[model samples]
Target: MSASLTLVVLMAVMYGTGVYVMLERSLTRFLIGFVLVGNATNLLILIMSGPSGTAPLVTGTASDDRMVDPVPQVLMLTAIVINFGVTAFILALIYRTWWLAQLGDEGDTLSDEHADDTEAATEAVFNQVDLDDEAIQRVLDESNEHGDDSHTTRKGAGE
Candidate 1:
């Protein structure tokens, strides 16, 4: 079945922009990219469903060949629902990340205090994971006994 040139080009553009945006380090950009890609996928399904005809509702005058297929329309609705759920999940992630960073209304400004807090939080997580490994913990303990102050451990860690 033939598809519209305009639609194909628009889909291509959407896909390209979505991928580019998703590659960024920002979670908000990733959300926007995911939305763009999801809508483009719905458009793709619509295009593949063949040319539009009469409404899917049965009418005495319209034959089967003149009636539009409803499967793609239903699929698009389902895709929309899935996209909404995923969007909500991503929004929650953004909120949690912001909360963890504990930023104020400063807006995009990472002060030294905030940066150090974030770094310490990250290091704490990594150190906890490392401590769970027995061999790594032994090495850390041995290094500490030898007067090597490089490895920093959190208080009450591995307790």
Candidate 2:
């Protein structure tokens, strides 16, 4: 097929793969997906830039149609910088996630039994009380006794 047709198909495949991989729970997969999508975006910007024409800043006389719009090129550069920053931030987050997940031994695997156990553990952790009523009352009472001098203590509206 034609070059443009090939690029369109490639872009579409990139978008599809990016979306599919992003849906995975793995951080590495997500990062790959993000990069794929970003690359696809760059390709889209490049393709939409239209046919190449004479340089806009050429000294010789040139018709308006012959001069390329440099805005898309500028935008593509800006997007590249922005994508770099965003990817860097995401990479940091992925590193942190991987580091945290590495706390367990090397035995951790995505087996069905492990998944069930993980779900149970997650449920147990989530079921824990976020706030203890008695503890909150004690803190409030202490704060009141101290005339709420602590900066971290929160006072009720009526108090």
Candidate 3:
């Protein structure tokens, strides 16, 4: 097959696959679809760049017609790079979504129980410590020097 025909066929296949993948329910499939479409777009830009020719160097005999169009090449390269970055971002989002899903609904319940246990343990330790007024004032004074606001510290329910 001719080069143009091959490029056209490839682009069509990629585009078709991209559209099909995008219709799936999964985010991972969506990312794949996006990548296929982006690749197709890059191919389209490459096709628009026209046939390869000698370097565009402006010599005494060199004319614009004999020179290759650099604009399309530059545009195609830029588009491919941008598409790559977008694909990476989309992949990251997909990974995050999958990770969160894997955590399951029970994870929240477990985390809540763990938090409760931690709070109870902290309270137990606090009750065992007997800080006199002088010690408390010294801690507050030190906290001020360290740029910490003593008022923002968590207070017990009785306090």
Candidate 4:
């Protein structure tokens, strides 16, 4: 019916689409959702300002009836720039994720062989330290001796 009401409807539709797209797992859909949300927010701002009253600039013989509210327009400009930045960043992230996915390393959801390798590596790292191993014992001894020597040297230098 009214222009303000139409804008409100448009904003609601945009928000609904955004919410739906955000639920999707695909990165493209998520990006679209973010854009939709940004647009919806911008539209809401415009609608809340009501109809433009008159020219924003002051004139020598200006009437009070028609001065447009320039605040919403300024806000909309800033919001558009911010949205553009966010969209660009999202696209870059999507590109990086796609590149990684294509490189045969699909993160934690790997194939059987890769999963097995990952499990083995994780187990190896978490395994108990074997103090009985001759090499490990020797390394530990060396480190202790080095530490003692360093401490002695520092003490002597301080004195």
Give lDDT per model, in order. 0.83, 0.78, 0.76, 0.80
Candidate 3 lDDT over 26-118, as tens digits, reads 888898999999899999888777778878776767365678878887888898899889888988898877645544353332245466665
Q: What are the models' TM-scores? A: 0.61, 0.60, 0.61, 0.61
Among the numbered candidates, top lDDT falls to 1
Decide which is better by TM-score, 2 or 4: 4
What TM-score does candidate 1 get on C-alpha atoms?
A: 0.61
Q: On a 0 to 100 scale, what is the lDDT of residue 2 in model 3?
A: 29
What C-alpha lDDT does candidate 3 achieve relative to the native structure?
Answer: 0.76
Worst 10 residues of 2 by lDDT: 102-111
Summarize candidate 1's per-residue lDDT along 64-90 as a digit string, tens digits: 678989999999999999999999999
Off by over 4 Å in 4: 1-3, 105-159
- The full ranking of all candidates by lDDT, starting with the best, is 1, 4, 2, 3
CA displacement after TM-score superposition, residue 45 of candidate 2 (Å):
0.9
List, residue by residue over 1-159, the lDDT tens digit for candidate 4. 145667778899999999999899998999999999999989987877767676787785647557777888999999999999999999999998974563344234345656676656644543544434766889999999999999999999999
Quote the lDDT for 117 in model 1.
Answer: 66
